[model samples]
Target: MMPSPGAAQPPSRGKARRGRPPAPISPGTGPSHRAWLEPVRSELFTSGLTLDDLVDRSGYSKTRISELLRGNGYYPAWELTFSVTRALGLPTPPLRRLWTAAAREAHKGPDWIRHCIEQVAHETEGPPLAYRAFCETLHQPYLQYARAFLLTDPRARGVVAETFDILWLSWNEAAASPDIRRYAWRLLRSRVMLRAARHQDGSPDLRAAVFSTDEAHAVQDPGHFMALTELIDLFEAITRLPDDQMDVAVLHYLCGFPDHQISHVLGLTPALTRAVDHHARATVETLLNAPNTQE
Candidate 1:
């Protein structure tokens, strides 16, 4: 079970092994978050705010902030994080870069889905009707949104598949629904949240192949890697914005969601939503105007 944030956990004292040394990376520790957040959390501790203190300030649950620190959950929206920084009386500094690094580390989809899709296709080819129906109806758009929504979740594809599997079993019900997209999205979201509720041992999953160190390196030679590095830096800057602004930026700029739909989905007032979008754009512009960042 996950321990409560900032509460003193009972010590699990045990007899030490006389000869065996601890592994370089223990597999038993549960989910932890970004590499940079530890220092940030320490700074906050120095400021004398317990995890409980952060709840009211960030308007997010203590568990969510704890998740961010522990790196077991999804990458956080920037607004809430920025609120914590301000509450702790810290300047924004280079946190955006840190945020981008967190995003990169949190990313697990592109590879996992690649493997899963191929495997599924091979198995489902003979019964293309049911499989193809599910895919053609919901896969592309819904999968794209799920990938975006659960930015830090490693189980997005599985959740999406499960949602569709339900739809497959209830095709008549799905067809009868007045709004299939909404129904499917709601189902997928519930599944994602359910997974989020479960405790994850902070132990590292060693199986993932990292792209930043491998493919990113392949994008440029040692002498030219600076360009790739800078691009990464830009992403960090974008992540510095709070989630509302970030969501607006992503939905508007990337996903091409219009004002009304974005407002509808996010439940933001129209004027406020526009303001958030403007603020998001300005932040990006300011970041671009500044000096380039390095590792």
Candidate 2:
């Protein structure tokens, strides 16, 4: 009888009695191969990255990555693996162990290959409940912040909810996979721009709309009130900048995109990204100083 993919096969009694045992299994010859590879692949996919992305980041060739994926070539050398792990900010231990094992199984026979394939299949079919839990953990903080942001602009309430819904849906489908996050950021930037355009004239009054009459009336801490007022004023000043500059600034501050990621999302070269960021900073500085001069 054939052994199940994850199950160990029993040794034949005749072979055992013949004073010769079966050859020892190699490191990668059992059920563990897919156990290792699948999770790493899933992580990369969820991170919105691909093998090609790793190649780009690591300055490695596409063919090398393809060979690694197919389990037909040299596994990533330690240096290459370290570089890839750092670039993606992924945990390395699991992938490292899997690769080590796969290397051991390289010359082993068909049983090892079959076991690896089974592991891969199992890994790819992830647990739905576990995935949902993961998504909720990732999104809860962002959702809270979005709610707070929306409270100041009732006009944006529906749109903000819709945006969150889309974000959550996309995250579930891919777990905020890097590619989806990139795409979502673009959509979010567009939505922010569209909302700003629609309510450009009324944005000042919209800030006032957030504070209920009771809350507005009951504020006795002058410093707290002033700080809130200053923040609102700062946002207003930001809105006055040109679209490109404003976008870079908002993405940097509000969405927390780094300059390199911003460049990719915006299709700007590094030099152009720096220039826009510099201009936006100067503009905001000028606007911030204007209020003090008026006082």
- Tell me, by lDDT, which candidate is best: 1
Per-model TM-score versus the true fold: 0.31, 0.33
Supply candidate 1's per-residue lDDT for 172: 42
Clashing pairs in 2: 46-177, 47-178, 48-177, 48-178, 48-179
Candidate 1 per-residue lDDT over residues 72-142, each given as its tens digit: 44555555555555454443434433444344456645554344223311211122275456566556544
* Superposed Cα deviation of residue 2, candidate 2 (Å): 49
RMSD of 1: 20.0
Once model 1 is optimally superposed onto the true structure by TM-score, how far is the C-alpha of residue 287 displaced, in angstroms? 2.1
N/CA/C clash count, model 2: 5
Error of 1 at 5 (Å): 40
lDDT of 1 at 4: 30
For model 2, the superposed segments whose C-alpha errors exceed 4 Å read: 1-187, 193-222, 291-295
Q: Which ten residues in a row have the lowest lDDT in candidate 1?
A: 202-211
